[model samples]
Target chain A: MARPARRGGGYWVYLIPSLVLFLVVIVVPFAMNVTTSFTRWSGVGTPTWVGLGNYAKLLRDERFWASFQHNVGLIVAMAVVPTIIGLVLAAALFDYIGRRFGTRTASALRAAYYLPQVLPVAVAGVVWGWMLHPSYGAVNQIFGLKVNWLGDSDIALATVMAVMVWFQLGYPVVIFMAGLQRADPALHEAAEIDGASWWRRFWHITIPQIRPEIFVVLLTCTIAALKVFGPIFVLTRGGPGSATMVPSYFSYLNFFQKADVGYGSAIATVLALIIVVVTFLFLRLQERDS
Target chain B: MRTLRAPGGPPGRWAVLAALVVLAVVMLFPFVIVTLNAIKSPAEYSSGGPLSLPQGVYLDGIVEFWQRVDFGRKLWNSFLISGTVALAAVVLSVLNAYAIGIGRVRGRLWILVFFLVANTLPQEALVYPLYYLAKQAGLYDSTLAVIVIFTVIQAAFGTYLLSAVLGQFPREILEAAALDGAGRWRTLWRIVVPISRPTLSVLVIFFFIWTWNEFFLPLIFLISNDNQTVPVALGVLQGDKMMDATMSSASALLGIVPAVAFFLIFQRTLTRGITVGAVK
Candidate 1:
């Protein structure tokens, strides 16, 4: 029932405008950044070739290292906590709400859960910063706790991580809920017939079914945690003496504020390399594991 | 078998529902606070917890806040930036995705993968470099320059998503159109566009919301008040009037109003975007 081959060159005509625009805007700029990273340019004058000087400086730079460490901390915290909490929340919701409510309510609830996602990160960061304000803010006032969220190095990173989690939880929860909805109900029914406990059924049936969702959630989240910026900017400005500085924030400060455009470009180039390599390795590892 | 009266079920369900309601309320409390506080007098805001409801709904605070922040002009700027960016991005992405999705281009998979890799790069890393290039081109502090970058950076991911959608679409439809002497442009304009409206609309909403709320881009690119978007404008307002809850809240409200309107308009599609086969 295969149709005969047809001849047409219309695709090329339609493709030209988009290709030119993307190449000039994205591809060219990206290549330029890579090239600029090896030079000593201060954003106003001619760029001088420095032959890996910027990369070497980045290697020994304590501030850059501090930012990397902060990102590592955030990635670990965000990756593990949100995935687990989101999964648990989905499980409880599916077990309880899925069986009782009609399809419309379930979807409405899902939308409610995802409201945070529509929020601009800047607004979320600002609102959260205000909420965690030390004196008359709701978080402090509600719990009668007087801790400064963005101050005091000990708690600054954690506070940022908490806000990140709050802002991020909705996406993963909805993802997990969708995964749960797609899982085979018969497996649960069989477990029910066998008189398995709710916890037991979840462990045996639900967890294994949604492994792919779990993996995707973890990967996307780890990458997002590494790239986090708006909250850091709005809340702490990578402050309390670099307590909350992440690689993105550090790179931004260096390139723009510090006027070390070459070094900043180099840091950014390295970050891009890290993301590509890490994601490649992760996909490879997942393929092998499966 | 368990029923509503089962030993550990009915009451437990109620408890869970109650907890969820509480969570929802807590989640929404900030909006309530920002709304009420923005409507209160400056003196009232300074005197009590920001979470406290005002004694009366006062327009004076909102009026003063609006004037101080230049809310109307900032909102118009934000609308212009975000609207243009989303529109241009959708056009570019739809075209790019169409090329790769339906065209006989070689290395299509590689192109898609390159876009994916580019999309994952930390945005902060590119901020300074882009700024440098813009300044070099004498486009600094210009609205068009920011819109160009926003549209471009966003187009990479937009292409990635739209291409994924296009790939899932059956090519037979396009092939059949071609068999009937319909050209690629005609086929895409007549056939592909109609089928892909759902995905395209979702993309539009996503881009609009993100572009509207974006701060880092505007912060670096827009150094002039005339170029500032709502979010950047609000940040400046906060800096200018430190600790003025009414002013800050009013700005926040203004920043969010457009987003809320967009969300309400496309609520169903937006929800579906987050859930429907999203993990893939």
Candidate 2:
């Protein structure tokens, strides 16, 4: 069919505005950030080049490493734990609750679970902060313990991670629900007819069917964890010292707070690069599966 | 429905529902607490249990919060800035997506691909440069600048989404219109647009919610109190009086009201919208 000669101004017109805007907003800024990393420039005045100094300083920067490690932990937590939990929740909903409660009620319940995703990060953080306030907050009262959720360096990152998981689960759950909806009912019925147990069908058939959705969720969650700036910015602000510092926070501090625009740009560039590489790898895996 | 009871007994169904309800409660707890606290007097808020109700209903806390937070100006600012941004972005995206997605002229494959790539780049990567650019253009501390920057940043994704929706549209309809002597513009307005109403509605809701909730762009672009969006205003209100629980709680409630309203209205669509591309 030769794709029916492919329709409207094809590539040029459609590409121009988006391409120009993106190049100006994304590509140019990214390049500028790389250049800034190499030069020492405050938010004001002209810049002077200082080759590899920022990277060198970053090499010995314990806080930078701490932030980087936290990002890795975040990505892992977002991917592994949430994926399992979301899958279980989705399976339970699809196989049990959803079918009984009726589709409308099931969807309403899903919307309730997904409500957090729509909330502003600032609001989410404050609400969580209030809830986790060590002394007067709900968490302490509920648990009958006086542990400072944000003040304690040891638990601060963990606290941040927990909030992140809670707020983000809604999106993944919806995705899993959609995947479950598309699954072939006949496979389950056939397995049941053959005397296959529910667990066996779920393990051998259900999991494989939704593998693509799983990969998509993992990729998004990882990327989200890597670029988590807003929630951390609002909730802990890198916390009782650098406990909750992630790469995004580190970059923000370097650029805006410290006025080390160059080093900050470098951090931003590295983070972008990491995201691109991760996304590329994810796409490749999907391609292979297809 | 029959399949459910056939395998898992009623107990199993109840157990699942209970767990889901527990998770739902966890999700809603903060909003509930904040609402209850916002209505209480400061002393009442500070002294009462976190989950307890107000001893007496009082608009005083909300009134005090409104004054301290300059919430009237903030709400106005949010409405003006976000409304403009959403409108501009959606309009531009509709034109762009229609042209590129359906009109699929000679080079659209590459353009479509470019847009897809553009959609994935982190918005954080663009902030500093945009900041400097806005400054140079004398847009520093202007609400207009925030509106424009957000509109531009959002255009790519809006195009990406609208195009996906437009892609499902049958080309034969457009072809039929074209054969009937309709020009490209007419075909679009008379044919493509009307059929694309559902997608457009979804985009409208999507952009409205996103622009309303957006924080970073406003934080970076609009520095003045008069120009600040709701999120920035809330942050500043917190910074200004960290101790006033009544004011803080009230401000939090104000900030969430619109989003909560939007969620309630479009609960079904919003969840689907959120998950649309996550698995694809």
Task: In model 1, state the lDDT of residue A76.
Answer: 68
What would the TM-score be for candidate 2 when compared with the true structure? 0.92
lDDT of 1 at A242: 94
Q: Which candidate is the best by DockQ?
A: 2
Report the C-alpha lDDT of model 2 over B145-249, residue by residue, as the tens digit. 777767766777788778777877896897787678776667677988788877676677787778888776787777877788877777544434354656556
DockQ of 1: 0.46
The interface RMSD value for candidate 2 stands at 3.9
Query: Could you tell me the lDDT of residue B157 within candidate 2?
Result: 77
Report the C-alpha displacement of residue B217, candidate 2, in angstroms.
Answer: 2.0
* Candidate 2 residue-wise lDDT, A57-127, digit = tens: 88888988998899987876677787888887777677656667777767767777777777777767766
- The C-alpha stretches of model 1 lying farther than 4 A from their native spots are A1-10, A101-112, A143-145, A285-290, B1-10, B46-48, B236-241
> Which 10-residue window in model 2 chain B sums to the lowest lDDT?
B235-244
